[model samples]
Target: MELTDLATIRAVLKRHGFRFSKSLGQNFLTDPSVCPRMALACGADESKGVLEIGPGFGVLTKELSERAGRVVAVELDESLLPVLGETLDSCRNVEVVPGDVLKLDLAGLLKEKFGGMETAVCANLPYYITSPVLMRFLEERLPVASLTLMVQKEAARRLCAPPGSRDCGAVSVAVSYYARPKILFEVPRTSFYPQPNVDSAVIRLDVLPEPSVRVKNEKAFFALVRAAFGKRRKTVLNSISSGLGLEKSEILTALERAAVAPSARAEQLSIGQFAELSNRLEELKNEQ
Candidate 1:
């Protein structure tokens, strides 16, 4: 079946009585070239297992099944299950799991589905839930080697931005800590069946074997990062002091020990600098 064919997709959805859910951010990809590129970006092959989220109409699922050894696609909307059954009927390697990817036991799912095969994730993610989903995968430190995702073009810039770059945000820092992110390509708003207002871009995140920077406490490290970016206009010292409820004198001391300038804001600090500051602060707290 030509899964990307707009007419074919309409017929399938009509037959199944499926309707797009606005709340779920349902925008099915109708561009033939997109799925192939997205599937290939992840470096999936006969030796690899793929975990797909929101396999709308099984378009990308079909492409992945053709390239990867196995594919487990998790769809949040149950109404699309039947639609997928018909579309992916001939794909022997694809299995559709009906549930929210965020809530699922992904480690268990990957273990059960892929076994020891090298795993990766490829998905045309919904714009609204993009950050939470990406964070879930990164924070869990899943066994996957990489993730190739389609997200809003603006979000792509933020996600791929360097830690100290102007486009960087708190999420950007967190993502950089876990993986090396790069923007692969862009997809126009018209590429979907129901066109969206914003253009989209594909980003590939190569998971690092170890974190980009190591700190004494992972939880405290993230908390510190959140605090740093919590007030973008404030200096890092002030933001950290206010967000973490620490004394300005103490934060100033930690910043000095880390060789970071007190006047610098969160956006001016790199991942290494953040790590250094976090470690120095922890040391000062221990001395108290």
Candidate 2:
């Protein structure tokens, strides 16, 4: 809210004598308004519990504690304990847990924090752990309401990308299978104590119970999708052949049956088309 946040963040670090580590991506959001926007984008409810990752200075945690029914903030940097304690002390609803968010079983942690509370996630995430953190929640298959994260703007574009875009890769398809993504807001580079070179955005992902398609074998379907995008310039047939260790003729036949052109590339196929290809693969497997 004030320049004091930068000063307070620094003073807290000085009193405790802590230095920010570059490897950990330790950029703290000093602008206080960003927290409530994050909570809102995340759909934080007084009745729903939230798990936040990388609560560097707990600036966001302070805001979340007011809006959510319960807030469990996972902080990897132990250096900010005194800072977090000072900020979150008045807020009995917030509990700061010191641990690497990647190693923590998030769903299990949420349950432990407040049993039977509908869970959601809100975080000012570290850029280094972006993929792993996003994948963990997206693949968890838990009862989370949604995940609203502050990530690199580039990552946001990738997550919300449509088919046929440069950003549409394996991660894009994998994300689409889990939930619909939307970029809610863009954060300026100057908002942090030490401004990161890259700008960031707040993106929300509404978790789905299952994929939008009716595929028999979801695992194999995703494998096929990943394989298809493994090489961007290659045709679907060639990409899949390399991945599945099948011949070009075999891939062509499968594509023909699915009504997809073998000349098409991975990014050209929609989720349903991919499912269709997967179904045809099953038929081919059965025939053999």
TM-score of each: 0.98, 0.95
Worst lDDT window (10 residues) for model 1? 162-171
| Candidate 2: stretches off by over 4 Å | 1-4
Q: What would you estimate as the lDDT of candidate 1?
A: 0.93
Clashes of 1: 0
Residue 1 in model 1: lDDT: 81
Where model 1 places Cα greater than 4 Å from the true spot, the runs are none
Candidate that scores best on TM-score = 1
TM-score of 2: 0.95
Query: lDDT per residue, candidate 2, 1-288, as tens digits?
Result: 232277777777787777889999888877777877887777777998988888877777877887889999888888778767876778899989999888977768877897998888889888989988898877777668788899999999988888888788878888888898889999998888788999999999998877777777878888888889888899999999998788788788889999999899898888888889988887888899
- The per-model lDDT (C-alpha) reads 0.93, 0.84
| Model 1 residue 17 lDDT score | 98
